[model samples]
Target: MKAKVFKYKSDGNTVVASYMELEPYAKNVYLSLSRKNEDGNEDDDCFHVVCRIENVYFSSGQYSRRFLKGEDCREEAATYCRNWIADTLQSAERGAFVNLISVRVFEALGLDTTSLVQAREEYKRIQEQKRREQKEKEAEERRVQEEQHQWLLNEQKRKFLDGERITGEMFLEITGRDGFDIHIRTKGTFNRHVRGIDRNGTVSFRKIKGCRTPDFTGCHKAVSAYLAFITEKEGK
Candidate 1:
């Protein structure tokens, strides 16, 4: 079942060119949202009548598709378009239908109206290059910060386990992403972002506080968990 296609000119008349149709898809294919027949063994997703405007040789524009047996969507579509045609014809005669999105205005607006699309392509390339540079810079900064902060966490863990004092070198190793390492350690590491300490004295752990419950329970185990986790990792 194809969709009912209608064309309306400046004259108050409509011509049926073609129509929308709904048909079943293959096993591998899924049905569209507004479909008549569902897909797969589950039968949830169904098929739909997708209508597209096609250009003929000289006359231009027709619509086509396969027909499904269930509903008369084409008739519904035709009815929907009928009102639009009536109003559009009235508007066109009064010349109240100026198109701001036309290529004429697009060209005037200094947008890329070139048939070659050279300017648009160049702009796209420049944007892509800029994105790549930004990503690389971000990644490089991330690497440096990770190395430094990991070092700080390691030192913290070292002090915690060895029962020693937090030292200055630990602070120097951790710096990046808006001093994230600092804020976290200050918060008291016990969260998801912080974990893992390398033997070379690189450490990372979230300085998460305890949960809100009776006795401020399940808190203050940040260092203990880190130590246990490190010990477990070392054993493995």
Candidate 2:
């Protein structure tokens, strides 16, 4: 697999200038270069190259090797690190376990592994923040929908209380009826039925059928207005 290179800033004197991951099994193998001297002084003309596979230093307890400031010197150190990663991958393929690490070994070396730990914690925090934001957004949308439904119910009830002329459909909505149907007869008569189910599963049916009154009267005007409203609503 192709290697992925990255960098990390640490609290120690050295900064991880270059980091690489070659393969899944070889992910524990780390390589980095720092530009600080042994006495914690910044040295522009020197680079400290360190290579390790999970606490076992390839340089045998010497954490790093010094390289002078030059393109040739930098490339030489990078080539060695890449070769070391390739060797580690071959070793893993031969049934070598590369995923295990010993805390005691790490403590003995006094290696600073805080950069990787902090990176994982930062990623987890970001994911949790996104989850919280999504939940809040969904809750706000439900609240707005409930408010709109309540406003519509109040408006329909006000029209009924104020003695205003309302369609049969409006009456059904205001009373929370589940369904309704209207049938107009040929002799200028009509049948209107409103149906609903109560909390105890009891069916309630209201039928106002065959009213042979004038078109301007109570039930007649309401049914006529409901038919007109439905025709306009359906574009029929």
Tens digits of lDDT, candidate 2, 1-236: 22323222353322232333222212334333333466764443232234444444332111233323434754554565556545544444453433222222233356443433444455557778989999999999999998887787677646644554444445556433322343333112222432322212222345447754324243444444554564575595
Q: Evaluate candidate 2 by giving its C-alpha RMSD to the native, one decimal.
A: 19.1
TM-score of each: 0.30, 0.29
User: Compared with the true structure, what per-residue lDDT tens digits does model 1 show for residues 1-236?
Assistant: 33332333335244333344424332111123332333343243333323222321011122223432236745554443334324433444453432322223234334444432343455457778999999999999999998886776866656645655343334324222213233345334323333443323345444448943222112233334444555776799
**Which model scores highest in lDDT?**
2
Off by over 4 Å in 1: 1-116, 166-233
lDDT of each: 0.39, 0.42
Alpha-carbon runs more than 4 Å astray in model 2: 1-112, 163-236
The pairs that clash in candidate 2 are none
* RMSD of model 1 against the true structure: 16.0
lDDT (Cα, 0-100) at 124 in candidate 2: 55
Clash count, predicted structure 2: 0
Worst 10 residues of 1 by lDDT: 53-62
